[model samples]
Target chain A: MREDFQDELTRVNRTLVTMAKAVREAMRQASSALLTSDHTMAQQVTARDAEIDVLYRVVEDRVYDLVARQQPVAGELRKVLTALQVAADLERMGDLSVHVARAALRRHPAPAVVPELADLFREMSTVADGLAAKIVSALADQDAVLAAQLDRDDDAMDHLHRELFSVMLSPRWPLGVEAAIDGALLGRYYERYADHAVNVGHFVVFLASGKDD
Target chain B: MREDFQDELTRVNRTLVTMAKAVREAMRQASSALLTSDHTMAQQVTARDAEIDVLYRVVEDRVYDLVARQQPVAGELRKVLTALQVAADLERMGDLSVHVARAALRRHPAPAVVPELADLFREMSTVADGLAAKIVSALADQDAVLAAQLDRDDDAMDHLHRELFSVMLSPRWPLGVEAAIDGALLGRYYERYADHAVNVGHFVVFLASGKDD
Candidate 1:
């Protein structure tokens, strides 16, 4: 209820949204690189991950400082602690984006997703971006509704991931072993990116409801 | 330090070890089931995962209560926060073991790993168990040395994972698409299981030396 607490909480919330945006951009660029075989874009996403780590550290320090100084118990404590968790989730979402980029980088000059499965991966990226935006809005507005919707979006991601698996497992699969590995792993990266976004959503719900679930 | 705080810290520490042991057992049994085609053991590992989740919640509640009630700062604060991080890592480690088990169960009546790759997965499981033991000991003794060694062990696990990849991508890969998916995913479960163990080690080092490396 303190004015100082309110100001600091707003700062944390702003930082979280900014961090989410950074990760969302990374995811988009990384997916673009994968779909288009843009080596330069992939490299950029991979290189930019260090900056995301710096943001993560900044959020962590702010959350810890809030707790150490204010010692806010009850709902205040939940809010402070959930900030740390949400920051971690966002940071990992950034890392998953980098992993997608790395997959592209690992097979440079050649796309990781085969022509047949490219559309599915493209859809996955779009869903991931949507979830990231929802998470940012959910955190900023403390909207548990938006946060919970991320799970449904994540379900869409999981379905795409499974579809990706079937492509690799199809009897008439044309891609070689290398493409199979790349596609499988690339699909997983996007799937995990969405999962982390959902995790942030759940953290927002926890912040709003004081429920760990 | 207050006596009651120390007592509660010890309780949390003990539950962490117990939880680690459960996950270790799960990892061992899951790997055994995969290597030996023991369906019952695979089922057991998957079934026991719920218990690990219960332990994770207990640790979370205790760590949060310690921070809220004790208002620990500085070193005490680091201890409480690191406890939370460590619990999350161990819980993920348990899930990874379940993943390994699920791999085996999905291929029921058939061994997931061919004779060629069984040895490598077995070695990975052994290495993971060794790392889990080191982590539990490090936490119990607060030994930075043991904690640091886990990263090195994790490197070994990664080496094995790369080796598994080479086998999957070999020119003469004997397995079909379905088997390849199972092998690749199972190998990853063990590799990632080790990675989470290393994460816990880093958390231990952070707790011991106040360095977040």
Candidate 2:
């Protein structure tokens, strides 16, 4: 019975890793759609978001069932609870990715990211993807050190977020109100995607270290 | 022992209600700060956000202890888990309020909401506060009916969010890129606050009905 419970716990962690990978792919597709004005790709990202949501539901239901049946205590309970929080953070990352995709769809054919700002967004995408990857590694390996590093990785995303705003608010910015608003909201979505990835990493850290810091 | 566990559960619920109240007050202060350009008030709101974080930590620790010690199952376990999710949503609501306050600070000595859009933002603020209040009532009473209504209440917030965007994107919009960006982000912050509130309500519904939908 104990071994069976342990297997269930391992399965839960594996599911979190899978969810993180899906979110990373969603963000990747969303970023590509935005930069290239690929309407079909953007539509695909938006549609696949429901798949991420389904994975989230699966994690939540499994955790509930495990705890109810096993009555896991101490370390085991913390791991189960952390899985739920991590799934939630991953689910929110998927939503933010959809937000990015919709921004692309809203200005279809015309790039959602103007050319001058395109490089900046691409850099943001890199950082976001990196953070998501770290979340997967941290969860799959239960590496608290890797998880702790996400906060520093998130700093790069934040810096890029501010850089995007600086470009938009510059006096020489040629884009008018509409483009500026799009840039602002898109910057927020990418930044928030990084934030959720960091949150999931923190849950991994908490699970490993038994420290909620 | 069961009676003691029940009392601890009651304490957890009460703490969630208190956290929701704090989040509501934070949002109210943030809106006032943004509209009035009250630098001091905005500063206060930003500084006081830690208090909300403290409340969040309290809920998490208490819930963890409750679950580990009591080994609750069935409805009791669900209630404990739901409390954790609700506390997280409320804590995030607090962060969004800080974001609004920061926007006001960024444009200190000048109103964040221009005079023309001031009425719309005020309406958003009212809806945001109302949602927070409903979260409090829903959690305190465990009223699935009241909790179920938050989705509709959130529609009003979504409408205002889109309205704010439309005004900023209009051809005749007088505000420059900076102000438009500010408006876009502020609208998003308020809209997300409502989203978190709705999430809390859903958890309440789940707690009462055992249905996650």
Candidate 3:
């Protein structure tokens, strides 16, 4: 019975890791599709979101079943609960990626980022993708230390987000209202995507430390 | 022992209801502050956020302890888990309210909303506060039907959001880039606050239904 419970716990972690990978790929595809105005890729991200949603719902169901059946206590309960939160964070990641993709799709042939702001957005994409990779590693390794590092990594995205705002709010901003709106929203989507990664990482650290009251 | 667990579950629900009330009040103050340029109210919202954050952290710790010690199962397990998710949704509602308050605070001397959009924002505030109230009642009653109704309530806010965007994005927008940015972002903050309320409601419905796979 104990061995069966342990195997179920391992399966939970594996499912979480799989979901994390899917989230990272979603971000990557969405970011690339946004930057390049790759309609097909953007469409792909939009289409794939349903699958990610299904995976997220499946994870939630699994967590509920594990808790009900195993009645896991202490460290085991914490791990299972953390998996639920992490899956939620990843689910948002996927949703935000879809948001990014929709922005691209909304303006098909025309790239969402105007010329002056393209480089800034490209930088944000790098920050977001880097953080997504870190989230995957942190989940797989249960590396609280590395997961802790993701908070600092998120600061870079925040800085870039502020930088994007600076351009949008600048008196000399030539992009006008529509493009500025697009730029601001996209900057936020990427920054928020990174923030969710940090959230998942924080949950990992909490479970790793088991330091709750 | 079983009675103790049930009592703890009751305590969890009470704390969540308290948190829900706090979140509702926070939105009221923040929205009033935003519309009126009430610097003191805005400052209060910012200061009060720390307390809300503390409450959120405390609720998290309490949930962890309950889950660890009780090892609740079936309906009991679902209720405990649902409380955790609901608390999180309320926590985010608090954060979004803080964002609204800060937007007001940032433009202390000058009101954030221009005169034309001010009435629109004031209307949005009314919708948000109404939704927040509904969330609290939903949590208190565990009324999945009432909770489900809040999603439709959120549509009013979404409509207002689109109304605000229409003004900001139109070619005739007299307000320059900065004000437009403020309007756009504030609209979003309010819309998201309502969305979180919907999320809390949905969780309530899920728990009430006891439909986890």
The CAPRI classification for model 2 reads as high
Q: How accurate is candidate 1 locally (lDDT)?
A: 0.86
Chain A agreement with the truth for model 1, given as TM-score: 0.95
Ranking by lDDT: 2, 1, 3
Which runs of model 1 end up more than 4 angstroms from their true locations? none
Kindly list the per-residue Cα lDDT of model 1 for residues A5-46, writing each as its tens digit.
879988988899889999999999998998999999999998
Report lDDT per candidate. Answer: 0.86, 0.90, 0.85
lDDT of 2 by residue, B42-81 (tens): 9998999999899988998899899888888877888888
Q: Which candidate number has the best DockQ?
A: 2
- Summarize candidate 3's per-residue lDDT along B139-192 as a digit string, tens digits: 777778888888788989889999988888888898787788788788888888
* CAPRI classification of candidate 3: medium
Clashes of each: 0, 0, 0
Listed for every candidate in order, the interface RMSD values in angstroms are: 1.4, 0.9, 1.5
**Model 1 agreement with the true structure over B25-139: per-residue lDDT tens digits:** 9999998998888999999999999999999999988888888888887778778887877888899999999988888888878888888788888898899999989988998
DockQ of each: 0.63, 0.81, 0.63
